[model samples]
Structures are given as structure tokens and as C-alpha cells.
Target: MTDSTHTIHPVWLRATHWLNALAVVTMTMSGWRIYNASPLFDFKFTKAITLGGWLGGAIQWHFAAMWLLAANGLVYLLCNVGTGRIVRKFFPLSPRAIVADLRAAFRGRLSHADLRQYNAVQRATYLFVIADAVLLVLSGLVLWKSVQFPLLRELLGGYEAARLVHFFAMATMVAFVAVHLAMAALVPRTLLAMIRGR
Candidate 1:
């Protein structure tokens, strides 16, 4: 297809992408502060890096970000489905293709020549992160309202188990974000494409 016939990142996608990014960052920082209030482990995130000055404030920030994430995520998912971008971009995944892509990536031979199409690794990773975000939201609901969501709480193996699941999900998301940013840095055009929709 000619350049005039396609856009790398559509406007709705770019909007949702930036909004989701903002929500995730806010939730993560506030979450660190909330986690510090009731230590799940001995370690604590530094006050400097965490959001909100106190536990109550942090909880407020976390809740606000939660709503933003939920609403924006819904829009993103619906748009992807409605537009059929989800299937076209992330479907037909295979273990063999992913393994080959991984090997090529490690060897610095994976191609990013096509700005519009995802390789097997990108498809897998994006799909994984989407599921991870859903898990985070479900587990977070249990923690946020255990009394109201007792069934969900029990399904996740009680309150404490939900917390653990949420923590791990957050960690996984953070790692994904880190690698995503690294890849963007390595291929700056990808970042620009998201912004410019070229």
C-alpha cells in the first residue's frame, strides 16, 4: 500500500494510548505509596518516587487513576474490536513464530521495517499485557471492595491472595513498560509514529 493509503497509528488509538499511559503511571506511583502503608514485604518504595504525601491521599489518587484506567481501557478495547484492529494486528500467534522472533530480537536482527504490522513477539507481548491489565483490575476490585465483591475475593483466593496477585500483575506491567520504552528508544521512529500517526 502507498503511504497515502494507510496510517501507522490512528487518532483514536493514539488518544487512548496516551490516556492509558497517564492512568497507568498515576496508579503505579500512588500504588507504591499505598503499598508502603501496609507493607506486604519488608521493603518500601522510596517516598520521592511514590505519589501522594500520605496514605489517605495515595488512596484517593489510586482510586482516581483506577477510574481513568477502567474507562479508557474499555474504550480502547471496544475500538480495537469495533475496528477489527485487534484481530488483524495481534491474531494468529504461534509459539514457533514467537521463539524465532525472540531469537532474532536477541541477535539484533528482528525487523521493524513495517511500522504498521507487529511481529510475533510484539503480538504475544501486547496480548499478554492486555490480559495482565484485566487481572490487575479484577484483583484490585477485590481489594478495593472485598465486602461487596466477596465472590470475586474468594475466587481470587481471599483478600491477601488478591493483593499478591495485584502486586505481581503490577510488577509485570512495569517490566513490560520498561521493555516497551527501551524498544521505542532503540527505534525512535516507532515512538514518533505513535505521536504523528504516519
Candidate 2:
């Protein structure tokens, strides 16, 4: 396809992407603050960088951002699926191709010329993150409403297990965000494309 034929990210995708980013960041920060209250791990986040003021405030922020994240994610999923962009741009990933791409990436030979097409690693990462997001939402629900969602809570192995799963999912998403930001730093145009849809 010619340069003019290349399609940028649709407005819906771009808008939802940024909105989800904001929601996730807010939720993650506030989540850390809340986790500190319960002493889940040895390390704790300082209040300076965290969203919300205290445990109660953090819970409020987390709940508010949860709604935004869920709604934005649903819209993103629907748009991508309805437009066939999910399959067209990210499907048919092969293990062999992913291995080859990893090899190329490690050797500093991976190409990024086709902004419209996701490379094997990109496709795999995106898929993994989507699954991770779904897991986060389910686990979050179980943690939030363990008694109300008995089946979901039990499926996740009860309240304690659900909290663990939720923490792990949040960590995975944080790692993904780090790598995503690094990739964007290396290829600034990708970030710009998401912002300006060029």
C-alpha cells in the first residue's frame, strides 16, 4: 500500500487508548496505596507519588477509575472487533514467527516500517495484555464483592486468592506499561501516531 493508503489509528481507538491509560495509571497508584494498608508485600509505595490521600480515599479513587477503565476497555474491544481490526492487525500469530522476531529484535535488526501491521512480538504482547486486563477486572470484582459474586470469588479461589491474583495481574500490567513506554521512547512516532492519528 502507498503512504496515502495507510490507515492511522481511528479516533475511537486513540481516545480510548489514552483514557484507559489514564484510568489504569490512577488505579495502579491508588492500588499501591491501598495495598500498603494491608501489608501484602515487604515493599511499600510512598504516599507522595500515589493517588488519593489515605486508605478510604484510595478506595474511592480505585473504584472511580475502575469504572472508567472497564467502560473504556469495553468500547475499545467492541470497536476493534466490529471493525475487524483485531483480527486483521493482530491475529494469526505463529510461534515460529515470534521466535524469529525475537531473534531479530535481540540482534537489533527488527524493522518498524509498517506502522499499520503489528510484528509477532507486538501481537503477542498486545494479546497477553488484553488477557491480563480481563483477568484484572474479574479478580478486582471478586476482591471488591466477594460475598456478592460468590461464584466469581470461588472461581478465583476465594477472597485471599483473589487478592493475590489481582496483585499479580496489576504487577504484570505495570511491567507491560514499562516495556510499552520504552518501546515508544525508541520509536517516538508510534506515540505520536496514537496521539495525533497520523
User: lDDT of each prediction vs. the true structure?
Assistant: 0.95, 0.92
- lDDT tens digits by residue: candidate 2, 48-156: 9888889999999999999999999999999999999999988899999999999999998999887878899999999999999999999999988899999999999
lDDT of 1 by residue, 28-118 (tens): 9999999999889989999999999999999999999999999999999999999999999998899999999999999999999998989
After TM-score superposition, the amount by which residue 170's alpha carbon in candidate 2 deviates from its true location, in angstroms, is 0.5
Top-TM-score candidate index: 1
Question: Which residue pairs collide in model 1, if any?
Answer: none
**Against the true structure, what is each candidate's TM-score?**
0.97, 0.96
